[model samples]
Target: MISPHKTLLSRFYLIGVVATIVGILVVAILNLATPLEFIIAQLQTLRQGGEFLWIHVVAYRFAILCLLATFACVPFLVILRRVLTPISQCLSLKNRQQSLPPPLELKAKQRLINLPFIMAPLNILFWIFIPLCIFGGTFAIDKIDLAAAITFFIRSTMVGFVSSAIIFFGVESHARKVLIPLFFPKGELSLVERTAKLSILKRLRAFYRIGSLIPLAIIVLTLFVLYLQVNAETVSGKTYGQGVLNFSIVVFILSFLGSGILNRQISRSIADPINGMLDTMEEIKRGNYQTRVNVVSNDEVGVLGDATNRMIQSLAEKELLRDAFGRYVTPEIRDEIISGRIPLDGEFKDVTVLFADLKDFTPMTEANDPKQMVQILNDYFKEMSAAIKSKSGLILQFLGDEIYAVFGAPVSCKDHPSNAFFAALDMEKRLKDLNKRFVQQGRLPLSHGIGIHTGQVLAANIGSPDRLSYLLLGDAVNLASRLQTLTREMDARIIVSAETKQYLPESQTRNVLVRHPQPVQIKGQQTKVNIYLIK
Candidate 1:
């Protein structure tokens, strides 16, 4: 009993003492006020017929037995302490303390949850002994006849049953509210296997038996006994039977009161845990996956709470993975791949590709500190990537001083050329604003060149089987790099091939772009290329 959870066991042991006191009180009242007195009066009236009653003599015998029964509870309490000691010891050992074996922890939980059921029959058998006590003590000591002895046994059994019922549920209430919590802390009731459960069906059975059936049965039996005793005398038999019937009804009402207490305890055991689970589920539905249902029972509802928590935990993990996944791909491509809107396999598609580069990147790196140069490159890429992505372009990768981007392949955009051209315009506009802030902070201003071309390329997941990347492969990719290099020689900040220029929107082209004065010759091309320069 000396364990960390001894506090819980100590409280339950105290409750057991209090419950036994109440049980004795209930049994004492029922035995004294109703059965013994009622039966003795019936016997005196039937046998002695209007004679001065000797009910006082029977009362003396019953009083002596009642005194002994009260003292007998002392040993019963000792037995109770013995039963609770193992449970206390089990609970005292922490669930994970000293690496308690799985079977041991399961056994501890099973034993605690089954405590109410375990105590029920034990209480019934103990109280069931009271009837024999009454029949033996009174028959030997008071010299009561066979009829009186039978009456004492039946009446004592009835009252004793009521006491047992009260005690069993009292133990039940305490175990659910107190002991089970310490044992099965997380409330995964279903996980506790092969155990006797006091389910709703069992509750309904007790309610009927304690509240209605048992009491009504006793009432009928008493009335039948009175009817038999009165049958021998015709004059007052009817009036006397009515009197006995009235007494039986009063006892029945008292039994219903005991049943009501049991019902209240049953209600608490079922309703409270369910309400808590419902509140936690509402929070989970509102996107608070971090919230978990409090499992506080080893019942069906407790299992449900445990299952709901599993689902919430799975959702939290998936969301975390999604945030991590975003680091590797654009949200657009990520969504497309996840939604299965785009396939990963290779296919040839005519698409526009763009590349931007720092014109004098090698000299810039030689001049600035290594850390400051990386910071500047990242700061510039951050804003430039935003501009490219604004027109539905995916920034494929960031090479040193270069932004590799594509449009109209992975996630389709019909105006791939126009989208690429406008993204270049946005980059130029944003750089001017960015340089002012950089100059204000005493960091060097930055500039870059953009090149755009539209042609066929095989777009697919590429690389070794172990590590793959979605990449565009073909002359279009190489030509775009060539066009960006031509930016320095051509003295242009942003340049575009004639293939892309053909697709640019007619509305903006006549006003915003100018044809390059010379034909652009590239290393890998068989002929010179016509191009446009961003003004």
Candidate 2:
């Protein structure tokens, strides 16, 4: 099927050409039938030409005059075809895939819009000169009925002017509705600015104003002629009154029909796309981001569609990214970062950092196949990571056989220290379940230690511009790692620093079995730390 833009454009040009040609022919026929032949017969009689000669001579003259007038318009037709040919050929193609190139398309639109200005004056001149030469030359002949000749001249002149006006207005309207929209595409949405000076809506309204004068002119001319005949007493008052009524009725009917057709054409050109956009907006409101408006034209409405699609597409992409990025951080932190609520530079917050390591990872690696070691490591990390995430802790880093997590830094929590302790306990329970399966498969049972410390730490994106990571910096991170090493010395599954123990609420501490506190000096720390072992 032809595209809507192409179809509307084709119809516009077709109507324009048809209206112009038909208007001229109608006017010419009216002129000939009403007054031209009678005027010719009177001229022949005055010349005293024999009746036989008069009959043959007058018919020949009328035919020659009409033929000359018709032939004189050929050059104007050629000019019009040259201007409109590209548009016609482009739209006439059966395959829509063969779209006109951008430059050619713009050229075609430029020519189409300029068509009326170029043809209207030329055609107007043709109409004026043709009527003047034929009637004026004949009127110059001697002894003709002066009144009859004058009437023929006046009537023919009126026909010419009215016909010219019809063609001009008709062609202008077509350019606005068809040519502009069809040639300008969605990609050229901004180019509508370039046409501000030649706005189609403004031009169409101007044509409507000028076209209104045609019927008014006809009314005045009819009344003037009737007044002249009445003064001369050549026609009865009743006949003149009847003629006025008939003329008024014909004008009203034609004007009403013409207005209806113009109204429909103008309204359709603008309404269709707006309605499509409204429906698309409704779809978007219902969260249907995938929906897109079918761009039917290159005007303002098409531009609006393009912008709307881009906005929805952007939202869809962000949703996809949010889901994918959420895997790296807790969903709360992910939402905070994406929403620009998180401070990326760095911030100090009290957080419990947990570090867990396989108790005998080196021995396990030496005994097992490399693939088996990898599988074991992945399974351990997956189980531990889920436990940590479930407790609202963000996994900061995974250093081979070890996991580091932070709570209440990127996103604050009033009970983060306790949450970290509970997550470590959950990890111990998950590890027990994993080891039972490993022993059933004749594999060694796995054991790990977790050390958690609560303190003020600097959490920030740190490293080179090209490569950076969210790190928990300051003595708190060191304290956590040091405590993990002490887990083996203390012969405990989990160890908590004095700082972390103090932060845990009594309600949570009551559920956890804790060993008596011990004062131990950790490596690289001058001050001794008090720590408790979890049973």
Candidate 3:
């Protein structure tokens, strides 16, 4: 897809092309109007001096060649845009898929591949062949001393080649490392890897910057030396050396200005989207999901911003769902659902279910004030619930002073039977602790009995559409309740069925005193079930 950033870049390129075309037309018209006669006249006068005056002809031809080259180069730039646009689009797509940020090495290799394909051939024609053509054209047009013209051409060519090589490689390398990576697929880089790469690039850039400065200084120094040498040899009235100095200064200034303009454009192209992405990321970190990166171009950075914004929107929606779900379900259940570990439709599983109730809750309610009864019940339930949770067993439901809990349901534990046994033991220990506090207060302690039974039960959501409870149902759940009823007969604080006893490890089961296995008729079951008591 054509990104907004790419669309903007295309528009900018079109505008640049139009501006270049107008500039070429203006220069061409000026050349045609001035005519070649004026140039020819100036050369004739210079030739009359005892000095072999081919300099004037060479200078005039150079100007004409430069003007024509500008016109040719502008069209080549337009062709370059045509070639680079599709490649930019492909890179935009690739960046979106990359999870790991692109490495500096990979980025360097890509630039190496693209440069030769897109610009190398054009650079050879424009920088190398074009200068040769200018010198040849001047030699033919003025019919000046061929040998003198060749010597000047050779000198100019050497300087131009050195200067152009330094400028091209310096700017291109900077663009590849800094500008291109920002726009391309940037995956997360490890700390060590990122730091090492950045350090290397920083050193390389510094070296290149210093290298570029040296050549620039040398070029200026050479121009100054040439000026002094020429002035020393020429008469005061003559300005031949002055003219050469002026031409050289103008060429250097124009080249510097052009390079500066290109660099600024490339920097802007790289910086705009990267800055936008950083700003958007900061907003996201601050919990502002409303923020979106403005698409400035159709390049890689623009595509990244678009994708990141979409991801933030998705995360915001999930946050909302989690907040809503958390109000109804426990965080554990919410996490299980969100993580896709627990299916919405619950499953049948083998679970050790526990049902506990205050033995004389109804009498306590009749004897005590409503507030006092509630306080006592809260104290009891809190202690028991904490014990159950500590064992990783869920408190499925709490009705009045009665609590229903289960182990190995929503999530299974390998030692679920042992976990349930520990929970019951802990509950008994807590009851003794509670009684001690009650005795110190000069009040009778509260008492509770727990019955645990292990069997397959349908564990699921039970209740109306508006109100739901995660609970277990079947003969196993009823057997647990029946066992709790037998607590009074067994004279035991904790009771378990024979089946539950079998599930516990021998280490834990060894502590229990089996009050001879007796078949007891539970309310829902036609057959009697054997139960045990823990001493």
Candidate 4:
């Protein structure tokens, strides 16, 4: 989208060029058709009783020179447009990227590039040559030919200098856009580098704009003083030069001052919101999600800030949701959902479910003090939970001293049976370690049996409205629990169902010395299921 500044500049350029052309054409037409006899006749009357006719002659010559100057300005303006259009395009692109440096830096850069060539020369022309020209012209009309001649020469020099400065400034300002890529060279800058560049650019722009006002103010003051000086002579009813001078001075001062004020205001309006946006962006870069910018003005910057704030808020909310969900699901599942890789709804997947139970828990509780049993069970559960988590398995639930864990539910793994088997092995190792501590403390040794089964199960959140438990419920879950009960009958520490034993890789399953593959009828099943005892 084209920016408002670019649009405004384009319109201004078009209007200025059109007006300049029309003015030049009108002046040229007048010069071509106007009778020199009539002008000479009028000038002769003004020159009556003067010491010389040199003033009238000089006035006619100045008029002809002005007519030629205006004509020449048209082509100069065309050449300026040719040089400036590409530069303007570059500036427009730079502005759109919003990579411009800060006001101070921009001012510095402008001083380095533009001041020496454009501003200083123009200032000299306005302050030295133009004033000398006007005063010299007046002296010439008063019959001091040598002084008038010098003044005219100074005035012409000032005009030439000023016009050249305008052309050079316009072209250079536009060309900066084209040459920026070559001098600055576009590459991916780190955040800090980009921000520093932006700061410099912004500062440079501010300084350039502020410095421009000084020359403009001087010009306005000069025009006003000149107007008053000429108007004072008119008050004595001598000539119309004073009225023309006064009107011209008023118009020039008003135009110059109004343009300067408007340009400054536009720049400030653009700069303020951009500054606010940069601050907010810096906050975000520092991981400050809580920072927000106010949309005070109904402008493009205001809208952008509002949008940025909204995006930050949205990201914060998502992070909160992800953290909360991590508590109920595995980090793997949470990440999958957050990354949009997995759907929320649970799917029927083949998973190995392991159930570990404290052997003869009721008798052990009766033998020990109730409080001591509770403490022992708490420590046992903590150890088992850690074991399961280490192998990337989720502890679905804990019922008293029994633990129900599942692998390949929320997130799947090709080696889920092996992972579940290792988890059970680790649990046994941890139990032995606990028993050693208990023995050292003169307590009873801990005994537990784990049963592993692999099958398709419906795994999801299940419970009443107030309470929810993410669980696996199917023949597979039942077979796993039943296998735990059969551990006592088989006189084994761990039992694996036929399905689990088959699914486990040969290398891992070879270590499991199966005592028997017994076909036993589960409580809810019509057919008997084969279960193996791991010796």
The model with the greatest lDDT is 1
lDDT of candidate 4 over 92-175, digit per residue (tens): 656676554465344433332332244324433433544355547655676334433343344334333333333333433332
C-alpha RMSD between model 1 and the true structure: 5.9
Candidate 2, residue 421: how far the Cα is off, in Å: 2.6
Question: lDDT (0-100) at residue 370 of candidate 1?
Answer: 97
- Native-vs-model 2 lDDT? 0.69
Q: Which parts of model 2 have CA positions greater than 4 angstroms off? A: 1-253, 362-379, 433-446, 461-469, 503-508, 524-526
RMSD of each: 5.9, 8.0, 15.3, 17.5
Q: Residue by residue across 376-453, what tens digits does model 1's lDDT show?
A: 887888789878878878878888889899988787778888989999999998898888989998988887888899
TM-score per candidate: 0.71, 0.63, 0.46, 0.47
lDDT (CA) per prediction: 0.73, 0.69, 0.61, 0.60
Candidate with more favorable, higher TM-score: 1 or 3: 1
**Model 4 spans > 4 angstroms off:** 1-321, 324-329, 344-346, 362-378, 438-444, 463-468
Query: What would the per-residue lDDT of candidate 2 be over residues 411-430, giving only the tens digit for each residue?
Result: 88988988999999899999
